[model samples]
Target: MSNEQAWEAVVVSKSRAPLDGSNLYRRVTVRHDDGPEEKIRVAREAWKQIEVGDRVMKEAGQDPRRA
Candidate 1:
């Protein structure tokens, strides 16, 4: 991650689904700064803090954070 760049994206959607039985998998679909829409798996708390239209930032090794 030496060449990591900080970039921002807009959250378009969020979802959660069962992972196995009791656990769940959460994800968010974002429109990137570079012009692509991508779905990224995120932690429960992070997912909770995010909403559609929120801007998120990604800086290499770090997980995307609400901006």
Candidate 2:
């Protein structure tokens, strides 16, 4: 596969789970080919910001924005 194809296949899995007797939490995994994966936990509010930022970035050709 080409570099771009490999890059596209880079696994970035996102999921969420509820905390016992508390609000739900989110987890994001960023993995590289044959390398260790990075996991992060974020609260709901922070997760919203992340989701919004991702959408805007994708729509704007992955450009950063001030909001």
Best by lDDT: 1
Q: Estimate the TM-score of every prediction.
A: 0.82, 0.40
Stretches of candidate 1 off by over 4 Å are 1-6, 19-22
What's each prediction's clash count?
Answer: 0, 0
lDDT of 1: 0.86
Off by over 4 Å in 2: 1-11, 32-34, 49-67
How do the residues 10-51 of candidate 2 rate in per-residue lDDT, one tens digit apiece?
225667877665867676554434566555554566455554
Q: Candidate 1 residues 1-67, lDDT tens each?
A: 1326666899999999996888899999999877999888888889999999999988877888899
